[model samples]
Target: MNAAEPGQPADHVVLRRAGATDARPAADVWLRSFAAALPTVVSPRSADEVRGYFRDVVVPFRETWVADAGYRDGIVGVMVLADDELSQLYLAPGWRGRGLGDRFVGLAKERSPQGLTLWTFQVNKPAHRFYERHGFVAVEYTDGSGNEEREPDVRYVWRP
Candidate 1:
């Protein structure tokens, strides 16, 4: 049911500003996507914990966007930005590799014209490659300490 399936090209998908109603669905996408992709990098929070975190803390606090999946009941993905940093970006399991991420970054660049920075766990090689392909460069690496997950991470920067 992913909107990215063959006939559904991503270019036509609209990225919209997320609202209060989107909090839970967006969080669900985040949790499911994280569960599918990041198990090797960090221990995931329980589903209830993730739902609470995103619904209460993230969606309400961050400037967030969600890609409309046309006919689908929920969003195709979610992006949350904090100032000049790309705090989070998660696509539904079937939505990856559909160019929606590049589109998301283009939007992020528009929102933060100065530059953008993000942190991703070092073990997430696909994420590292994706950001690099989109012009992000690794600027720093940290041992598992500062982040809640306490997983080693790398900081990436993108300059206009």
Candidate 2:
């Protein structure tokens, strides 16, 4: 069950640990969210590049979660809880701003009491604001690679 606060819509958003069966859909959502959010950074990723990313990076991250809108069919969002860090959290563009992210974070925190930490693209102002609203503080920043073509990333930490 979701560990959302009372009256939070996330309380209704079903959250569960992702298994092998969820790989494809979870990857799909991850790709979609990344593509949608990437244009704000350096450049949009090609389909091949996104697929390769899923194959190389995302799939190997075994700890994943999928959030659904109280349905058994479609997925609304996905999150990766890796150790004490929140490695990835992505909601479908259409399903954003409805407290799904908060619910996902809440569930992750409930399961792992060390609280949550994440890295967000520095250019993603909205995400920065959302994380700040959720009590995350920027603790550090790093270049998007050894190269300077891409935007930097800000590391955020949330202490419960």
Residue pairs that clash (backbone atoms under 3 angstroms), model 2:
none
Error of 2 at 154 (Å): 0.4
User: What digit string (tens of lDDT, one per residue) describes model 2 on residues 1-160?
Assistant: 2323334454466787765556666767777777787665554566667556555666565577888665433666888877888888997766677788888777777877867888888888899998898888999988877334467888999998
Query: Which model scores highest in lDDT?
Result: 1
lDDT of 1 by residue, 19-124 (tens): 8888888888888788889876555577788888878888788899998776763588899999999999998887888888999999999999999999999988
Q: By TM-score, who's the top model here? A: 1
* C-alpha lDDT values of all predictions: 0.87, 0.73
**Total clashes for model 2:** 0
Error of 2 at 103 (Å): 0.3
